[model samples]
Target chain A: MSSHPLDTALKLAPSASAAGHYTGQSSPAYWNMVGPFGGTTAATLLEAVLRHPDLLGEPLSLTVNYAGAVSAGEFEVQAQPVRTNRSTQHWVITQLQKDADGQPVVCTTATAVTAARRETWSVSDAPMPQVPPPEEVPRLDLARAVEWINRYEMRPVAGVIPQQWDGSGDSSLSQLWMRDQPPRPLDFCALAAMADIFFPRVWLRRATRVPAGTVSITTYFHVGLAELAATGPGYLLGQARAQEFRNGFFDQTAQLWNQAGQLLVSTHQVVYFKE
Target chain B: MSSHPLDTALKLAPSASAAGHYTGQSSPAYWNMVGPFGGTTAATLLEAVLRHPDLLGEPLSLTVNYAGAVSAGEFEVQAQPVRTNRSTQHWVITQLQKDADGQPVVCTTATAVTAARRETWSVSDAPMPQVPPPEEVPRLDLARAVEWINRYEMRPVAGVIPQQWDGSGDSSLSQLWMRDQPPRPLDFCALAAMADIFFPRVWLRRATRVPAGTVSITTYFHVGLAELAATGPGYLLGQARAQEFRNGFFDQTAQLWNQAGQLLVSTHQVVYFKE
Candidate 1:
């Protein structure tokens, strides 16, 4: 398989100042309406930790906070292993950039937990949603969409798109079959990117698309490396729904499932919106 | 009403070193099986941010990473406002302690997003689970439970407790009605504590109570300050379920709702467990 643009965009090199710190540059290919795609940013942050020499096991949970805007420039990331237990390790990461005033500012903050796994009692309560096979569904045509939107091939399986809303539904539930446009190997970075691939819930509930963006997102990975490699580059089922929308903020919870009906990642995020 | 112990436990004194720094002492009344209860530590971290001199709006989301065990003595916390936008502000908090070698260690790391709210389109999709009212349900007797379990009055509504497990079910789901034991007023601290009050999901699914604890927890608060105060000391319904459990870890997604069937907070956590 050919190398994907995402790999090049997320590439990072060691920084001279710190051992676990690295410097990365943004790519125009993944630009969103405001800044770089949140998914790619999340993926890059996770990458910083995954590349750490002291890293242990796989990612169990990751939380990312979009503290500030990211301009099109170079940014420095510091990933540190705060504590490492016998079977688990915790990490803290920060993405820093110079503000217009030339002062250092934090643009993003993340915490991730990595732990070794042992076979134990297992079960899945959330069942995979019933949807037509990927071959039967039509791929979303995003010729005029943002550069980041064009990076994913999405096919809606449930709920109507914003433009197709008839103003009849009160719930903001959406299910789609999505994967990397140019099929990349399944790994932590790709799965992290897919966790934030869902559109804001507000767009699914309201006909008019008001300004909305995710403020904070937390994802819990269920599968390990073996399961991810088994799934390969096939399409994964994705589902998202809003639990509550109050005032100017709403909370969205989503799940990404492999084609074999195994849950891979579950994510939750709070978004800001305007009427 | 008199002051609740929870308030005294979460109280903080300003640190002389920095504007957003504080010195806090852990309370023995809230100790868990390990060190301090994770919920109280989470509440203390949020308290640090809420008590900041330059605080803005209410908390929309908070994620806390339990990096290491916190001793029962004293700890230093630094809560910095990393970024403040027009309507939103982001904070990064860290709890520091001295290790055996007298070096500074990070016991917990957290990121929170606070924002001002304006009236907008609102809806709730996750309906309150059907169960007996708080008055109808019997409060659990935890005379032999951990010190922290005595801090709240919890009444189970779904899934059997570990002792009640008949070795017949495979799914892990638990719903309960809970609140402060002495009827403390509803606020962000108490609500944050309640989010982690549920027993580990592994205990609920398996008859054996293995060693388990939360590694990371992220909560999204849907209501503002006024709504929290208006709800007062009333009982709040809480429900938690595991989506997938494998290896030595599992993830639990939970929700807290008011008596009016309004969703107040949605939380997710990844737990560490051993057989």
Candidate 2:
């Protein structure tokens, strides 16, 4: 069997001397307008943690900070378990890139909490949105312009896409169906990436694509391996909206749910935007 | 003029020798059921960044990870700018505690993004909920059980407080009016703490207070100094709800809005809870 493009993009090689350090090369297949897509970078960092020797249980929460520009080239990642309790573990991961001066600069910083989950009384307050099935919705046709957009099939059920920026909308909510183009099995890494796949909230609310980028994003996973495997290679409903957009920044809150109405992840991100 | 209890609790003395390290002593006034309240700990961490010599503009985003227990005593904090761009700066701050064996253990890890705000197209999609004025709302009386409760006055407008938990509600929403006791002026540090003031969503949804604690929290500040100052010791509206609760964990998303219906901060957190 051939390797998935995403797997090939996120594949990391360990350093011979360092235990928690890794080297990975950027992939043009997942390229965004600038550098690489933020979602792919988030997935790669979580992948580092998942592949760590000292990793504990599954990821409960993950936060990624896009500190600097990630140049398209080879980069290094350092993942370490900063603290470990009986059942929970905390990790700090950093993505480093060498500048023109050959000095290593931190491009991204992430903190992940992993713990062994136990059976408990479960409740979901945010009900799944009533929308048509993926088979009925038409896929967005952006495979020609955005490389990353081609990696996934997106079908919008509510709100307009960012490309349709006409500067006339007040609502920033977007509900859609999304999944890998090639139908890869659902997992924590892919879910982390999917959490960031929404367009900037400002773009949806203002209808103008001013300079905007996500400064930081946080995702909380509410499912385990069994639940994820049950999802298989299918579309997951995604909903995102902005609460406020002001003073050069805005916050986007989103949720990803499986077809079975199981909430997989809840994510929040702060984006930097300019007029 | 005397300093406010919150200001005193967040105050840190810079180390004469170390550039980015500081010493802080936890305050009993802000103590929770166990040690210091997680909100105050988050504020102290942000305070360290604010006091740093190399500090940049206001905070755009902040993520705090509760890695371990924060003992009630003096602790050390290290805040360093890992990446500095022309318009943005990224910092990594860690709260360190020495174990009985004198080895350093990571208690909390935080990442902060600070940047200069420029003119931008701003819009708020979330409308502030209509609630009674602060004078009309009665303050929750829980000063005897939680010391931190005494530091702030909270008036619930939506969900029931944990003390009133009778396991009767299926909704996890909570909207309340909150402000520092004695009416202290509003600022980023205060807003940061206020973001986490809401009770865990599980407590409101299940109506039972099991063993629950915040594992990680991320807050995005949408307003600048002027907007915060305009809020000026006045009561701010806080709204929080859980998206999903499953397998020993739950996630809370919250927002803080001024009396004028201006949104100030958006926050999200994952909590560890037992059945």
Candidate 3:
């Protein structure tokens, strides 16, 4: 598949970076070899793209098929303009990581079905969720190296961030004010990472402390809408439902809506339990 | 990883069968090499799982990752009992197919999360979408000779079936009386396949002449309760929202609910298109 000149050129291009520290790029430890699942890696890569200005304003559908087991490695976003449209652009973004062969492993080659931003007729007229603002909500730092979470500065509007070893059970539902540290413009990829983080908040809504469940989430991104720039105190309401929790695995569904009350993105996760 | 003595035995057990007449295999046409965006074959495999009796109670969350680009051969699923509760059973299903070694490819595994039927608790409900009775809807026999749709019978309430292919781009909503020709216990797997088929019906609703849409559906399966059995007429309501569509890919959410108004299952799908 890589036997073309463009492929060679694409391979040699420098990696894209968001440059602005607004979007936090968390520590490397969390992304390497810790979890065997591909979802974590995909989420991490999405952040990398979100920070990179070159990849902004594009809609991407990242279908990360767990291609066997992937090893611990660093990844970069390599997107190139193949065609541009008045309203849309077709481009490719590849997750580049060195395979065991010392050769690069294209963890994923996604075709971003991007388009030029259009004036949305949506007024986002709905009121924010009837919850306390972040200034009122207590802030608690997690013990884990905030690799991905580091990019987005999150202030809980309701509860504290649970530690990895925290035995205290918390409600599955959570409200928070999330913003890039430097206030960078968020892209489609960033919205995905935001949606992915909501399931934990939902878990907090239920119990005081929960046995962190392992669930596989598959997201189908439809439209490209930036959330970081949405009007308001700049927070998206995220709510999750512990839909089913039987067997050793449970499923959770989460939805993210901007301040104006339009559904921005939704996510579904299936988790494995420890107990 | 095969640590238990029963591991090998579990691996050898034949996968449970659904309602289809053919039990052991699927056509190679839906192979990824045939098309990275190939979806119908996967749809058929899903159909077989739906009809398989042993898989009846087991819940399904099938995510066709990477548009399933490389189909070396049929990826088959076989189940193993993990745990059983008074209310629900826990089953983990392993999908088997050949790897590049011509050896078995270790496809992703999914565990069914089902809750046991319980006494009445706090109740919240959503009314079933209103539509014509199943007997009033038209039929579409879009089954392939070697494929799977023929395994069951569908009676659409508002429009014609795909087999008829009467071109009409009207609405993307329809109701149906769907059941196996030889009736079987309605279960989670069946509901999954129903969600799969009903998705196309949404497009069918808009078909004034022929269904005109090419798509790759992304779906999220909700925990299903066998709530439909009590319906006197036993007809099912399948509804879909063309949630969002842009840049050639669109997403629609679908569900299968019984006549009693009990919600059976919820599904979300993202389909890609050009033609």
The candidate maximizing lDDT is 2
Give per-residue CA lDDT, model 2, range B1-275, as digits (tens): 89999988998988775888998998899998777999999999999999998988999999999998788888899999998888899999999988889887899999999998987767788889889998899888874568888899898888857666688767889999999997998999999999999877888788887889999999999888899888999999999988898999999988899999998988999999987
TM match of model 3 to true structure: 0.52
What is each model's TM-score for chain A?
0.96, 0.97, 0.57
Per-residue C-alpha lDDT of model 3 across residues B1-275, encoded as one tens digit per residue: 43321111112224446322232333332222233122343343344444445443444345432222334435665543333434333333334466568775433223333333333211112347677676666765663432334545687665444444555544555556676434545544445545656534334534423222322333434334434345433556776655443345555555566766655655655554443
Q: Give the per-residue lDDT of model 1 (tens digit) for A1-275.
A: 65697898789999989888999997678899978999899999999999999999999888999987788989988999988988888888999998779888888988889888878878787889889988899999976788998888898898757766555556698999989988877999989988999888888877557788889999999889999999999899999999898999999999999889999999999998987
Candidate 2 displacement at residue B180 in angstroms:
0.7
Scored against the true structure, residue B138 in model 2 reaches a CA lDDT of: 88
DockQ of each: 0.81, 0.87, 0.09
Mind giving the per-residue lDDT tens digits that candidate 2 earns over A1-275? 99888898899999775888999988788898887889999999999999999888999999999997788999999999999998899999999999899998899999999999999999888889999999999988864667988888899998857656677877889999999978899999999989999988787788887888999999999999999999999899999998888878888999999999999999999888887
Q: Model 1 misses residue B59 by how many Å?
A: 0.6
The candidate that achieves the highest DockQ relative to the unseen native structure = 2
Stretches off by above 4 angstroms in model 2 are A162-164, B162-165
| lDDT tens per residue, model 3, A167-271 | 444344455666544444544544655655643433443333344433345555534544445533366666665543433444555556665555565555655
Q: Candidate 3's error at A146, in angstroms?
A: 6.6
Evaluate candidate 2 and give its CAPRI docking class based on DockQ. Answer: high
Compute the interface RMSD for each candidate structure: 1.2, 0.9, 9.7
